[model samples]
Target: MCIAYLLMARKNSFLWLLLLSLICTLEYIVYMGAKPAGDFSASAIHIDMLQQVFGSSRASISLVRSYKRSFNGFVAKLTEEEMQQMKGMDGVVSIFPNEKKQLHTRGVLDSGIWPESDSFDDEGFGPPPSKWIGTCQGFSNFTCNNKIIGAKYYRSSGQFRQEDFQSPRDSEGHGTHTASTAAGGLVSMASLMGFGLGTARGGVPSARIAVYKICWSDGCFGADILAAFDDAIADGIQLPLELFHGNEKTDTNISFCCNDGPVLASITNFSPWSLSVAASTIDRDFFTKVQLGDSNVFEGVSINTFELNDMYPLIYGGDARILQQVLVEQI
Candidate 1:
């Protein structure tokens, strides 16, 4: 079977030249899949592939840069035998030589904790490609302009609010916030509830937007998420940057509805921090206390209402004084 892969030349030209002079001169571009058959994430696929092929984590440190947003492929450097072995892997689609090409053209491509009034009119600011079909100003009916490339919403379950079913338009403010921060047009003399009064513009005022309303206030189901991913890939979404939470094990245990069966959204232990954080309703708070050799003390966020009347002995590192052999905790 013919497997697919994407290979890219390293960014630094000098490094490439050094390799050509001292190391192997031959270079090949390889394309490999990241997304799995089920609603499983490309992250999960990458974790599985790395463990199966590489002997250690360091092996992947400088070699592979998996494109998570694209969810379909990654760029890596491999020899003929390694490339041939990749083709036999379960998720491997195809592998071939890199078709090198270059073009000289003037082109461009961001806001705030999301600052809305920022100027995107500077260099590298422009509309998206005309072929893009994303939406703008909240999901609406058939809306794609030069500035707004594409728009779509995925709804697998009818359990959402009645209004949500009407249009992919953002019923919740989150979708709008995300869009505006990335590509909202410059609005002169803008303010938030009469605060931060000034020009309110997105990071890239000229950049066009493609709205994909996949989440909701209540919650997003697994099937709907998969549907959204399918549509996004088909509609030419290049990358996704959503974060994933961590647990003791790499496997996330989160399940996704797939055509064949339900698959777990397994990720590695070293996955990056997750952006999708939710607040908890616990009553307890944590605090930290530290003591220095200079008799200086540091206190952290103290949530407990009670105070201790007794004082405890402390120790400091590098003081070379074990008078009472007192131990000190710096946490």
Candidate 2:
């Protein structure tokens, strides 16, 4: 009887382990499918400046016509009739009103002034993964851990100041690039039918963008970076924790930084809504030699890659076609 009972117990344990493995595999598949294959970082849109440069014809028409304007104040709110009219115009695909919410901005600071060697706590913020708490340069240690989020630097007022909440704008183009990559207007493949097939679009083009000029022109910051994150969290968008994995030999030589492990934990503990993303480049040489290393752990998260240039054109140019392809392929 004892022997029979032992055999039965072993059989049950094996069955349970098999079930768990199956469940994990299914969950991974679902996660991979849901992940977007594009970037969704923030970008700056100086409507006023753009309007001045391009004039009201294309600028105003696109903003008003596209219904993509979302700043403090400017043109009077459009009425339902006006909205209808704009939607009916040529080349018009869809228009969405910008809703006010807490805004999140990201940027890099001047590494020379701020120094990547500075500690994290000194900069007045904990790493994304609170567990990795200690001290390290600004928040780059933490920021680098999660490539999805940009780095933070120490700011001492001036153009990068967070007090005014307006003006200066993101001149560096980093913020604007990020925003466009996240969500920009989609371009039609019909325009490219003859040029072979090239579909490029943002991860979430419909999402409204609010740029907070926080980083320096060269990229560096401190409080402003935290403010941006705080604002984003308060704005009600989900924020994902950062995850870091560092090699002891490599990381030791580095000054400020957090590993993916800590960032992921922080995202899980702090923000509940935002999802985390890991950067994956398509360059076989660069990715293989530097980024990928020996670890295949990041395969679980959604991955998106773009050329070093502005991701907006690609996103705005081919969003619709990509969506269509995805749907058709799924079907």
Candidate 3:
């Protein structure tokens, strides 16, 4: 009998073992497709019949949950062999073990300040799935439409000003820009200032947006990251997790940065589930500048040519040092 169950599990599904408990005597959660009805009395009657098929007691069977007319189904508890038998019953549609689901820690979005427009080959794909809920406040003009299916925010420390930080309404444009890059509607002749003007669109123009504002100007908190991740998974954002590709690897073409502290791989590196995207360059010549006291100026390399060139005093790394050594240093 043990071998029979093992063979059945192996042949049936990868999910079979996932959903079923290892113990032979433990209860299994089965999803049974139910009959349509104005009232659920018919489904209840089937449940009663299903109960009697076993031992007609709570010890034998129990309905964990039942779906309404919209989705005809029920989740029930039964032993492994009984669940197998339940699959063979006259009105039974399908049965499988229910298992716990987890969220991948990281998800990647392709690099860019974002393009004027991104074109994709979506020959076989259908329209985007709308599977999330929004948390936009009614009093605010910030809205969530069909294309933008979800909006959410998380803040573990209630330190920010209530006016600007009260809701998912993005004040800094960080959240707004990222959301647009992922699923923005088609815009004609979009550009940065008078530069790079062209038709702007997202990688999936038809795809819906789900916003999770886990950051503020200060920075994102660890607790907020967890909250955003939980909501993203619950909202059914099933796309692969993305992480940094350590662009500053100490080698050719990679002008390594010793300024940003010791090199450490982002969490996206360790997980096999993530797709680590390495940053690369384009043909467009961009400029970077470091200004000194008086008229002295040094130019560096970068794609961002739009720095304000504000007259705020520029100081060397030595000039910015403080007497207090509070930051933790690795010996």
Candidate 4:
């Protein structure tokens, strides 16, 4: 699957992912007509349609999630034959394979944040911006501070692993890293193994973070992502700059940065009113030295800052798995 990580400076980032139709076992997004009105909920209508198309037994097994709040749609695992049948079905707008996108280390307003992380400390922060109007919806073991102004989670499938947190608390570090990188607070002497030593900070350290947890262990689902976009827009957060082509300057408030690796058409995060950023080369690099027990030394490019003073056994990647299994058995 392709996962895109976005970083917005002082404002909300507007990113768009292009979906491609391909033959695979991957899940597909089944878009439908506008949400149904009246007492019949959109989710119920979607289920009913699925039952009619695939019958009750098959629909129950194939249906993954239903989109109700923002639009009318559902995600499911469908075969080519089933997809064809769905196309001919009434109320179905379009169906496309949930294509994969590459993920950037920088995160969008996604995942859940680790509120206890040092990067999210609110020691010197003031109240949220005057225009801020968001709320915290953490269920358990999750809280928001001035720095992380808001939090929310979505799981349309109503399924989660035993390890998954039911709240906006990050069990995996990905969300915390991305959230901090976008607008994290200042952290002094922060380094991994004493590397990259400095006061670690984000692009806009003063900006508040509002998280929308849409990803989980099964990977990010298309339905959840769309739901996040819907809520983010409703929360008065400015997103996506729909620009065709121009040399004109954009607004001073919204800043944009993205990689040029992907084709321009594939990336829809363009705006005539926002300045688009281009990548630049770093001024310096860090090198690491590895000293073997045999008194031989090897040098490589790395950000390692920790000083090694003792000799230790080196293990190969393949052997590490066996070692882990042995350790687990012992425990």
Q: Give per-residue CA lDDT, model 1, range 75-113, as digits (tens).
A: 444545555666788756665543321211101110001
lDDT of 2 at 222: 32
Q: Pick the candidate with the highest TM-score.
A: 4
TM-score of each: 0.36, 0.26, 0.41, 0.62
Candidate 2 wrong stretches, greater than 4 Å: 1-156, 159-168, 188-197, 240-278, 283-331
Candidate with best lDDT: 4
lDDT (Cα, tens digit) per residue for candidate 4, span 140-216:
57788888888888787678998889888877777888888788888999977766678989889887788888777
Every candidate's lDDT? 0.44, 0.33, 0.49, 0.68
Across residues 64-177, which tens digit of lDDT does each residue of candidate 2 receive?
Answer: 211111111112123343444544443333444433112223222112111121111122223344332222223322222221223323333334334222232334444545
Candidate 3: minimum summed lDDT over ten consecutive residues — where? Answer: 107-116
Off-target runs (Cα >4 Å) in candidate 3 are 1-137, 239-275, 286-331
TM-score of 3: 0.41
Clash totals in order: 32, 42, 5, 7
